[model samples]
Structure formats: structure tokens, C-alpha cells
Target: MTISVNGEKKVFEKAQMSVRELLDALEYKVGFAVALNTTFVLNTTYETTMIKDGDALDILAPVQGG
Candidate 1:
């Protein structure tokens, strides 16, 4: 399955993936929030939310600024 992640195209071995699983697969290490296909996916629901082919994912993390 192919999905656009942070504006870059990525291919996954599975046709479908849960939001949580995708994060684990990518080895995400920062505090972040995800937007899937233009919809906000709450962190509490990551395990249940599904990601499909041709989807767009924005993995945004908090940035520190003065």
C-alpha cells in the first residue's frame, strides 16, 4: 500500500494499517499528533483508526520556540 506521509510517498507491506501500528512501524519517537486524510485522529483512538491505500498522513510534533 502507498500513502503520502508528510508530503513524501511511502510504500507499506500491508494494504491496511491501524494508526498505532503505522506509528510503531515507523519507529516514531517524538510527541506527535496525526491527521489522516485531512481528518484529525485523536491519539486515544489510534489503535482503532485504520489507514488505507492512497491516504495522506501528517505526523506532526510539537516544536519549541521562544
Candidate 2:
């Protein structure tokens, strides 16, 4: 399956995977919020949430600014 991560398209070994699994696969830090196709996915739901083909994901973290 093909999914776009931070604007870069990449192929995955499989299409069915939870958000947590996906992040784990990419080694993303746990402090970030996940956006699936522009929608926010709850962190608690990541374990049950499934990502599919052509999905666009953006993992954003809090930034400090004054």
C-alpha cells in the first residue's frame, strides 16, 4: 500500500495497520499528534485505528515560541 508521510510517498509491507504500529514502524516519538488525511486521530485510539492505502498522514509535535 502507498501512504504519504509528511508529503513523501512510500510503500508499506501491508495496508492494514494501527496508528501506533505505523508510528512504531517509523520510530516516531510518542509526543506528537497524528493527523490522518487532515483529521486528528486520538492517541488512545491509535491501537485500534487502521490506516489504508493512499492515506495522508502528518505527525506534528508541539513547538515552543514566544
- Indicate which candidate wins on lDDT: 1
lDDT minimum window of 10 residues, candidate 1: 29-38
Please estimate how well model 2 matches the true structure, expressed as its whole-model Cα lDDT. Answer: 0.90
Best prediction by TM-score = 2
lDDT of 2 at 54: 93
Q: Which TM-score value belongs to model 2?
A: 0.92
Per-residue lDDT for 2-26 in model 2, tens only? 9998899978989578899899999
Count of clashes, each model: 0, 0
Tell me model 1's lDDT, rounded to 2 decimals.
0.94
**Per the 3 Å backbone cut-off, how many clashing residue pairs does candidate 1 have?**
0
**Which sections of candidate 1 miss by over 4 Å?**
none
CA lDDT of each candidate?
Answer: 0.94, 0.90
